[model samples]
Target: MLTLYRPGTGWLHRMPAGPKLLLILSVVLVVSLLPAHWSTAAIAALVAIVGYTVSGLGPGLRGIRELGHQMFSLRWIMVITLVSQLIFMGPEPAVANTARVTAAIVLAALLSLTTRVTALLDAIERGLRPLERLGLDAARCALLLTVTISTIPVLGRRAAEVRDAQRARGARNNPQTFVIPFLIVALKHADELGDALTARGVR
Candidate 1:
């Protein structure tokens, strides 16, 4: 899945999707390959702080709180990343890898928050149009990617909500319990989305 765009009236909201995407990509590249050292860790932390704090995506603290909410939803992934790295690699690598994931997730989440899904779709479609000569349905391919991107954050939120609800009820929240309901909810959302797209005449 791809994104969960939130409406805002900041500079980020007004920025074009193409450039925003390129910027995010650059960040992911930089952070993903960062050295697993203390200095790099501090740099990674600095980048993250600057990203979440300086970005005028929302009204002051409200904006920061929104990012925090998204991060909370992704707690499991971060935990697993750190744990896995710690076991297979070491503490430094664990920290570095976790930082990579967090930065990518948060920056990506920010992109989705400020930019419209339609805009992303259009940008992607335009970029891929030249490949239509190879029998590619540019529009369909774009829609597929757009849908993928759009569902990611929503699905993550759904997972978090379902997990929380199961905990609240004292139910055993294992993969089976979590996966089954998550799949069902995802299917339902897909069906609803399909109908919405059909009504809009989007093939």
Candidate 2:
């Protein structure tokens, strides 16, 4: 699996998972509240650069490169969106939205790069512990969160594989080739995961 996590010995990595998660949330809140300005976006990018440096930038950059490659492969969609924005709202709004989205993606990716899946889940469980008074089950919540995060890469890879296979078999660029197989595979994976969870008494 192409995980964004990078094993490191930096201060960010050594910090307790709880605080790291809180930091991510704080960044998100601040970014959301701030006006979408070039200066604010540049600061966010700088923070993401520091995060990348601390966590070892090789893996993170590689992940970003892979994302770029994927986007290039789907260039038509992006081109359509850009052209539509130019025709309707002009280039400035499109550029601002693009910067905002890019900053969010980079910041979140930095969080993943600095924190392991296990640490993330542990932090989540601890954060939810306070909600136990309201009949919330922390363990189950953590497990669900973990499963959901873990499955994203799996589903992504599976969809890519299915798409490639269909393309090789001369399937047209239609909804069925992409969507139907992905849905079927996702459902199958979900069913098997549920069965495994039941067998392990996770519920």
Candidate 3:
């Protein structure tokens, strides 16, 4: 499995997961509230660029380069979002939507690259502890959030692998050929993950 967490001594790496997650949420909400104009897209793109700069500064550009590769892994999804939004909402809104989505993706990839999965889960559980009396399962809720964050890269890789394998087999690059196999691969991974989690008594 490809791990998104990159070990680093950068400030982002040193920052606690809880505040990092909150920062991500705050940026996302801010971006979403902006008017769907070209300026909105520009501001969102600037935010993502700034995030990359901070990730690399003081630690050299290495962190930024590594994070960029992780971000690039999700390019297919980004492209699809761009095309679909363009078709449904036209160019202006499409640009804004895609920029916002890209910003969100950058924030998410940043968190996963810097913070350990366990640390993320622990932070989530601790935050949710106060609601445990309301019958919430902090451990499970934390696990769910951790899994959701971590799955982004894994699924991206899976789709790429499936597409490559089909191409190697001389299959035409059509939506049907790619999508079906990708879903099968994703489902298989889901089952394996479930079994692993169950074995660890995470259920």
Candidate 4:
């Protein structure tokens, strides 16, 4: 489920998946080319506000909060990015780079919040179909993208479940106690998914 989507009848939600995806891609391309950090920060805030407004306050806030939690989990990567930019490019560029990245992440989260997974996959497949002329498997690529996106939350929850089970067994709160069970659960999930796909005649 990825937990980002909020069911709604707002303009953003009602918008067709293909157009919305195109809009998101346009925004990402524009943001990537922008040089001013303040501009990117402003754009990010605006997009976030739009997400909240379209979500009807309650659901919007919940969606934003969920997205924020996901962002918080990436603290280490953000820190490393900022530090690297600061050391090599100076404070202004560091801030700009960080702002651009944050804006991109928020935009993506907004897209996921407003769009259904199935709709998103359809849009992705349609977009990729153009590449099928070059021998790419658009359907398979879309399915792969969907699987990757959906599996993230699944893996996160699996890790948490493993951690809690270890705690219940009076085990120490350490990576060593958690990693093996997590890996086992992951492998089991993969096997089941593979079997299901095979049964469905998916190559």
Best by lDDT: 3
Q: How are the candidates ranked when ordered by lDDT, highest leading?
A: 3, 1, 4, 2
lDDT of 3 by residue, 1-203 (tens): 23578687888888899998888778777887888899988998788777878774346676567546655666778889989999999999999988888777766777887888888989999999999999998899888888887787778768778877988999997876777788899899899888878987876
Count the clashes in each prediction: 4, 0, 0, 0
Candidate 2: residue pairs that collide: none
User: What range of 10 consecutive residues in model 4 has the weakest lDDT sum?
Assistant: 51-60
lDDT of each: 0.78, 0.63, 0.80, 0.70
lDDT of 2: 0.63
Question: What overall lDDT, based on C-alpha atoms, would model 4 receive against the true structure?
Answer: 0.70
Model 2 is weakest, by summed lDDT over 10 consecutive residues, at: 69-78
Model 3 regions more than 4 Å off: 57-59, 163-177
**Per-residue lDDT over 1-203 for candidate 2, one digit per residue giving the tens place of the 0 to 100 score:** 23456677667668787887787667756665656455764665565455444544444475456445333333433445556766887666554444454445455555565678778888899889999999999989987876765565455556666777888999987754577787998798888888877986986
For lDDT, candidate 1 versus 4, the one ahead is: 1
Candidate 1 per-residue lDDT over residues 1-203, each given as its tens digit: 23576677778788888887778778878987887876676776677667777667666687678777877887777887899999999998888878777777777777778788889888888978999999898888888877765666777788888899899999895876887887888788888888878987876
RMSD of each: 3.3, 5.0, 2.7, 4.7
Ten contiguous residues minimizing lDDT sum, candidate 3: 55-64
Per-candidate TM-scores read 0.79, 0.60, 0.84, 0.65
Residue range 1-203, candidate 4, lDDT tens digits = 34457777767788898898788768767777887565666765566555555544244366566556545544444666789999998887787787677666666656776788889889889989999999999988987876655565455556666767887999997766666788999898888878866885788
Order of models, best TM-score first: 3, 1, 4, 2
